[model samples]
Target chain A: MLYHPLVIFFIEQGVPVQTVLLLLMLPVVATLVAFFRQVVGIKAFGIYTPSLITFALLAFDPNGLKYGITIFVSVILVGMVTRFILNRFRLLYLPRVAITLSIVSLTILLILVTGGMYQRTGLASVSIFPLLIMITLAEKFVATQIEKGSRAAFILAAETLVISIVGYFLVSWQTLTVLILEYPWIILFTFVINFSLGKWTGLRITEYFRFRKIARHL
Target chain B: MFEFFKKSQGFLGMNSRNLEYIRPNNRKRGMEIADSKLLCKRILKKNNLGVSTLIAKIKNYEELDQFDFSTLPDSFALKPNRGFGGEGIIVVYARKKLARNTTDENKNNVWIKANGSTITAEDLKSHIRNIIDGSFSLSSVPDIAFFEERLKLLKLFKPYSYKGIPDIRIIIFNRVPVMAMLRLPTRASDGKANLQQGAIGVGIDLATGTTTTAILGKGHLIEYIPGTRLALSGIKIPYWKNILRMSIDAQSVSHLGFLGADIAIDRDRGPVILELNARPGLSIQLANSSGLKERLKRISGLKIKTTERGMRVGMNLFGGEIEEEIEEISGKRVIGSVEKIKLIGKDGREIEVEAKIDTGADSTSIDIELAKQLGFGDALKTFEEKVGGRDVLTELSKEEREKLFSSIPDLADTVPIKSSHGYSYRPIVLTTLIIDSIPIPAKVSCIDRSHLSYPVIIGRKHLRKFLIDINK
Candidate 1:
């Protein structure tokens, strides 16, 4: 069995095999997010947020999934708590979000300090990319909190985290990475899946539950 | 999957709404105009449509710096040029009266929001600064900030709306208004007319302007205005025909194939176009208890040349079903002013006649000649032979009247009707009336109405099980 020439050439060159595999995994992960949104009706902060968070988590801690989830959760917790305290003051939206992001950054710093004290090397040496990605979630969180109440904002944040964790597990699968490296042409199927998802005119799974009272009214 | 698909056959979801209706029908130019409030107002104003008067617009910080706040009207609405979902809009109810001996400079220009929260000139400037920076824009791009004169609440909607102006959302497709809902502001929604913001969406009957059902917040079916005993349904909207016509005009002028026009009825100006939405929410289905998929498909791809024809098509296709809707909600069948009623005559023979429905009368009355034609000639003969005349019965004592009434066969009861001449006694007979295919056993009085247009009149006595839609 022969691999595609592009993959062979990239491996022959100085590019790392893991980098090529992760790059090819982007479409698969994005397609899975699209399926969850279009068919399953799980709207989790849109496609880009969850997919980026998944890759960032994989880059942060490749083997230990629990550590990445903890860091991401603490960022959201800090954002929500700060907004609760700031609700009393009638400040403008941009500055209030800026304060929330500041608090989130300080909390991340505390998490790293705690990690170093406990000799958890993975958390102590977390990369800036994943940490920044986690902190960027605070802006979206605060915006949703202002538009929709806190309960809805919490639900959306939890949904985004759940989808990211699911995407993290899929991308980190050993067998999938090996298969992608062997058969590079398999990546093209993601486009076909997305085409069908784009053309899908069916009711989302959530809408069936939303319109349960009037489902058969027609 | 197939079962779920079949169950949601008439529903229009977000994906299908975008893919089927918005993407294909809404052109880029039309969507662009819909996105920008400034452009939409200009175009709608040029078309001679009713819209809120614009006070001022701030394009950049330089313009914002030079604009004076005190010269504005006492009540106004501040909005972002390219916002969506009713975000980035601030509605001020009135200006705060200045104290006699105030020392502060910035406190002189304070205004109150719909929720009664006071916002000073400095605070408004900062909010407008954020708007100019595109904090609430759809794409987060730079936007313009503007202010427009606030519309006064109509007297009819004073009880239904909380702290904001209630508006009508009319969904239009192919120049035809498909479905419409009256959005009432609630305390939870902070006085905005957006449904997702906890406002009430009441479905309006197209043919007639009466409300049918109401949904609160997201999809909870509600019977009355929250925290009040005022019933949500059955309130008639004034100027309904003009509102529908303006929606169709807004659609054609904007060149959007599928759109939703947000129109508010000002106490002074009548129906004015508030905003035009390229992508409208689907929660209107829950409000109407019907799906958009079926309605959109019913009128898709038909050649509607004029706005009047489009409106007629919509009302004809989606109208007159409010009877079934009202029946589902209030458990009462709605009837028209003139209905075909089948009378069960002698030996089970049925005679159908067009009866005039009069809620003013206390009892159902049948013409004397029509009753004799229905094989009641023997009862009439026995009544005339036993009693001298209706005037004679009127002159009889109570005991004599009871004695004469007991002698007539199939006599349910007797009713005294007072006319301009004098009081008269009519013979009541027990019979079954079939109206709109619903069999109603009733006691109808036989009256001498040989000169009247209708042979029978179904009064309020038999209208307990039905509602009267006079226009129908």
Candidate 2:
């Protein structure tokens, strides 16, 4: 494919092609998360969590990893604060998680506004703002982080982001995307995924926690 | 108001904005109407979809009496218009003469002959009363009943179905026949092919319009119609494309996005619509074992040219291709092959050997020796075996035959089990977890179940509904 002189200039300046690929791998990553964790019984925070977090990171500040790390740290702080509050009150798991997600999402909104006051560079990274996606995701992360505990939830969130980067790239791959766009016959991959999962009979990874009684039987 | 949730996507993916994203967003789910027979009929009629002719609507007991019973066609089927699941349907095959000297008191009652037997007028009245009580309708809402011309049985299903008229059901989504199955009424189905009441449903090959493997009840596979060699396969549904197109057109007329249209073929009149189903039964999945979600997803946004175009595309895509794909996918044969099943009993004894399939039935059973092998010796001690022949028990020496039968107390040499749908039959059982390969405990019975096409009937409580597509 031919690129204009401006595009060549950007490449010469070492624009991150890998990051662009990573940015596109969202849905595939979510699907893979569901396949291995939901169908093949691998435990994770949730199938879509990490991928959404990554998309929000890229969509929010565009320094994909930097944005992802900032949001993750803010989400964790919200989770810790929520855990402390709930532990003091002894709130049930679901309720504590709910409280945590609310605070984290609010924190993200506040940071976005404050960035404008702080620096042009940080603010510039936020163009084509998907403020809406950020707010919703920030809430979910905070909640999961609180309810499932920081380790499990953050790990899931991190895994989701990484796999999403992979997914983002795969979807952007010229051959695959072209087939999907022009032929649309290629969405058969989704069919392939669905059909294979149709006969899944083993315990879900969540069930490992749900039915740990397997240990008792053994 | 919902826009706030839609636009507020802080971090939860767009899929989780509202509960609707996770669950299917149902915009036009037809309310669970009282399943009104009159309303459904009117809607179908208004939409130009052909349905059974409306004979007469009988409201209260007075109106029921007002309708001259003798004036009805000899073969007309009396039905509660609001009847759900074909319940409250009375098919009068023929009129039998009353005793010449019978009093006027018995004259008003409706008692007709059934097969070789005679059910009293009182029997007919109770069933009608049950129909009035909304025994068949989804609700207890009082309903007006009507009678209509009975569908002449299609020659295609004549062998596979036991005395009942069979109907083809097509599920139309967005003016396309997404999936379909043929419901065959059997003796067990009592002339009504309502699956819940024990009908045989065979998934149809969409492309060729031929019948494929059948699901007896939920999951039992049957090839030969009960007691007949009529190949269930290769029987093409008449007016196949016309039926699909008519059903799709009905979707446009009804304005219901999702619906199951049951259209039966009348030998004289061609295809006639049975009834419109808002929420069709899910057994279609078991019959087809193919998912609907994926098919729906594929055609969601794509442009379709016309009804014919969609039908042609659907036929070209989905018809007739499943058996090969399923066999390849599941690594199993699709045909219901005949095999001789062995019956074993207590102490590993060989009882009777019979051919049986794991019907989507709940219990395992055995013939005499088969039951004995299942360790029913202790149970046999209690039953006084009542043999069918008048002298078999008495002439064998009352004590001797009773001793022979009493060894299996639970053994009813003959049992009169009345099915849920108001049908009765006598079958003999010999006791056996129904030690099959599946470790299912069951009461084994012996009868001329062999006389029936399916030697076994497995009920739901036995199959556990836990998704097992056993030997095909």
Candidate 3:
């Protein structure tokens, strides 16, 4: 099979193959998120959030999915603890979020230091960008908690994590990346699928659960 | 494929709502106007529609600093001009009265919120500062902070709503008012008429202006006012026609093809426009217990020119369905044309007998034999001896009728009823009727219903608390 001309040009220009592969895979991750939302009826914050979280997970050592999940769990735990402690202070909204993020950062630092001591280099030397992205997720969690109470916030955060993990598996599959590199035009199919998804008028799977009693009589 | 069809049914999904209705119908300019509360109110007021009076506005830190707290009204609502989802609204119930010999200048300006929380002048300044800094705006852009006159709650809704005024939300599509719901603030919602924040949404019937069903918090169906025995259904909203006319007028002027208009009834001002929404929520479907997709699709392309015509189209298309569904969602037990009723006889003795649930008759009638069995036999016998039968009863003059009625037993009265045959006088006796496990004291007339299949015929007088399902 002939290499796509743009891929060849990118390679000649000294662009990393991994970056190009990721750029092409972003749409695929987004399409998967849309499907989870419109069809499966998962409301994980908003569309951009779960997709970004998925990419952040993939960036945190693509081969070691368990490490990424562990870090994500720690970030959420730190965020929730900070919120529970800060709620008594009656602080303003922005400063409260800032304080929560600061606590999350310090906790992640401790996690890395402990990992380094244990010689788990993969956990110790995880990329800063991915860790930072995961930490930013705490803001959304805290905001939802403030607006809709902790129960709703926890459900949304859990759904986000679920969709992100599912997306992480889809994008990190070696076979798909190889196919995307060989035939980069496959990415355009996501747009077509998204167009059809946009036109979807059917009830979401969650809606069936929400309107179960109403649907029976109707 | 059939499974897929069953999954969707006729409900309106968010995707379909945006792509089919909002994208095509709601124009950009209209949405922009809807986004700004101050602008929307100004436009509605310019069109001669009723809106809450604006008390004051603080545009920036300079305006915030210069504003005088003592000059403000005892009660007003502080709100962000571009706030979304009813956020950043502080409704002041009243100004806190100052105690004698207390010299704290700040405490003089303290105001009580609807939730009974107190805010000092400095706290109010900071909250207004946050509003100017875009804390609650839809996009977090700088927004104007203004105070509006707090509307007095109507006497009818005092018990239904908690702390705040309840507003009616009407979803208008293609100028025809499609579906409507009444949002009441609860203690959990902090006295804001927003459904997502734990307020109760009661669905309103378009033709009759009566609430049919209600959903509390997110989407759990409720039948009564949280703690009270008052049924949420059957509440006939006053000024309903004016509420409809004003909402449609707001939609017409808004230029948004698909809209949600929130109208609140003031104690004296009547129906006034609270706000307008471009992208309304879908929880109203849960409250109504029906899908909005079918209703919207039915009137999608119909050319409705005038506001009156649009309202007429809406009521005609979606009106009568609630009459049937109300029985199911109203939390009342539905009985068939025939039911088993328990009669409480003399000295608390109970007897079970089949009764005909008649919606046609004004007063309940029972067989003379059954009345005698219930220990009302003395009263029946005395009335029969004095007034004779139906033929003799009708021939008596008014003076004679009054004299014969007084001579009957103290436990009985007489009623002149018009029947298919002609006019006749019937003896009425007081007894208790137990239907569907609820006890009701009723005035039932003694008649010769022995030829009828049922011994007791329940009339419309006692059927107010029940739903009659003929097919059952």
Candidate 4:
């Protein structure tokens, strides 16, 4: 197989080959998230959040799904609780969001220590970047909860989880990773797809469901 | 498979759209001009194109803070300069009545919408502040908030529009008006003529300037206006020729090869150009139930000289009278689903009967009872003797049939018709039909149509000289 020159250079420089492959895979994951949001019409919590969450999931070992879910649930719980408690104080917007982030960080720390006690080393070794991403997600969740009610926020959170899981599986596929590494030029196709997705003005698949009555006439 | 074929034939996919029309035809400068409503209005006004007059514009927060609200008229519209998709537009239809003894200092006018909802000055100011903050602009970029004269609803459109003024969106390409749809404000759209916000889009026929079909929200076909029995089709739009000319003119002046011109008819000023959209939406295709690709391909390479010539060419090419065009090419008059035809009898007696234009039938048929009333009973007797009954004709040899046909020189023609009961031979006779004020000779078969709605059915064979219009 003809390997990409950049991949050969990364191997020659003694860089972890899997890390180099993951770096190249980020745009592919981001493009997939965009497709889910744009063409497929899944209203997930923005493109970057799901993609980063998926990356954080795929970075872990065999127990990535378990660790990822634990982190997600803990952050949302702590953020919602902090927001509910702060509502009584009638504080300003910026300070309330700041406090929510701090609480979210503390909850992740608590999760890491509890996982250590339970002898789950995956949580103990969770990186800072993924923890920061979780904190950002918590902030967005709380903001959405305040702007649009709890139901809307929860629905958005569930959609985000669905998209992230889909992205995680796609990134973890062994054959796709190998093919992308061999044909680095395939990344250009992702760019083309993203460009076309940006220009898509047709009714989405979800819209077909919404307008099924009209489709029946057709 | 049918759905796929329909989509491929009529649907303009997003990729082909941007690559072929928008990105190539729309220049960056032209897009910027079309994006900013204030700038577009200025350019249009300078070119002597009629636009809603600008009353005032607040460029920044400082200007807004120093602005005086009382200087504005009773009815006006406030809009964001760079707004996209009809956002940040607050139209005040009228001012509420004030107390008799109220002085100028304590007047405090309240603006009311067509739905009878009122907005106080404080509420209006906050809305203006939101517009200035760029909440409704593309990408949330800071924008200018300006007030313009709100056009009075034209008498013809008052019944159709909820509270806001209705605008006609004409999509022009290569200086030809390709497709057009009238956007009517509905109660669901909150008196805004934005289709995405639930306005009604009625497709307008290019040639005759009459409405054909209407769609609500997106692509759902609606025959009548919601909560009313008023049919959406067949409404002749006023100042249609002028509207088409104005659309082509806007395209020429804006230098945008592909553009959508939104023109509103004022009660006094006739039709005025509202705005030019560089990236017009594709919902007009659904409104027209036709594809843009075919129309665009037809007018692609035509050498259009002036705006008048382009409008003429558009009306000639993409016009809605498919049947009329066929009639024009073949020197025939177009008839409708139902028409009144004057049947001249053998005794020169003329009687008018409503005939159903049936393209399914191969030969024109008249009721046997009506033929007797028309003094053609002897002709039927001769027809029966020559062709005999349906069974007898089926039993005849080919040469015998030819000899039988030659023997019947007095009979007009004979044809066997199949129905639910069985096959039956009908006698044909030559008669004169007065259709649409023109008299022509036609051979009609005599059949017992006592159970049918119309006494006479105009079939495809006799309808060769006329075109059938289903709408009519």
Candidate topping DockQ: 1
Candidate 1 C-alpha lDDT tens digits along B1-472: 5664576778889999999999989999999889999999999999999999999999999999998898888889999998877788898888899887988866679999876789988888988988988777864688899999999999999989888889999999998899999999998888788898899999888877778789999999998998879998888899999999999999999989999999999999999999999999999999988888999999998999998999899888877676765698998888889998899866676899999999998778899887787777778778767653466545888888888888888677877756665776667777789988889888888988889989999988788888887877
Clashing pairs in 4: none
Interface RMSD of each: 2.3, 19.2, 2.7, 6.1
What candidate 1 gets wrong by more than 4 Å, as runs, is A1-9, A81-106, A138-153, B1-5, B101-108, B325-335, B338-468
Q: Across residues B1-472, which tens digit of lDDT does each residue of candidate 3 receive?
A: 4664574568887877888888988999899889999999899999999999999999999888889888888889999998877888888888998987988776689899866889888888888988997777754578899999988999999999998889999999988889999999998888888888899999998887889889997798999979889899988899887888888889889999899999999999999998899998999998888789989989988998898998899887877565555656896667789999999877777889999999998879899999889988888888777765465455877788778787777455677767766676788888999998989999888888878899999999999889887844
lDDT, candidate 2, equals 0.58
Tell me the tens digit of each residue's lDDT in model 2 across A156-199.
65565555555445544577544433433334575577555544
Native interface contacts kept by each candidate, as a fraction = 0.69, 0.00, 0.42, 0.05
Q: What is the per-residue lDDT of model 4 for residues A1-218, given as tens digits with 9 covering 90 to 100?
A: 56789889888999888887887888898998889877677887788788888987775547778888778878877876787788777554557779988888887888788888998767788668877877899877876775554666888888888888898888889888889889877888998999888877664566444444433333
For model 3 the local lDDT of residue B370 reads 93
By TM-score, is 1 or 3 better?
1
Model 4's chain A TM-score stands at: 0.89
TM-score of chain B of each: 0.73, 0.58, 0.69, 0.70
Candidate 2, position B281, lDDT: 65
The prediction achieving the highest TM-score against the true structure is 1
* Each candidate's DockQ: 0.46, 0.01, 0.31, 0.08
From the highest DockQ down, the ranking of the candidates is 1, 3, 4, 2
Per-residue lDDT tens digits of candidate 2, residues B1-472? 3443222221121112122221332234232322565666677677677777777667777765565655655566777766667766777665566657777755644445334555445555555555665544543466667767777877766777777788988877766677789998888878778886679888787766777766677556567676777666667788988888888776666655666788899888888887777666656655654545446555555566588977986786667465566656776434332333344445555443434445544444444333444566445433323443333422566577557565645555544454554433333453333323333444455433434555444444444422333322
Q: Considering only the true interface residues, what is the Cα RMSD of candidate 1 after superposition?
A: 2.3
TM-score for chain A, prediction 2: 0.58
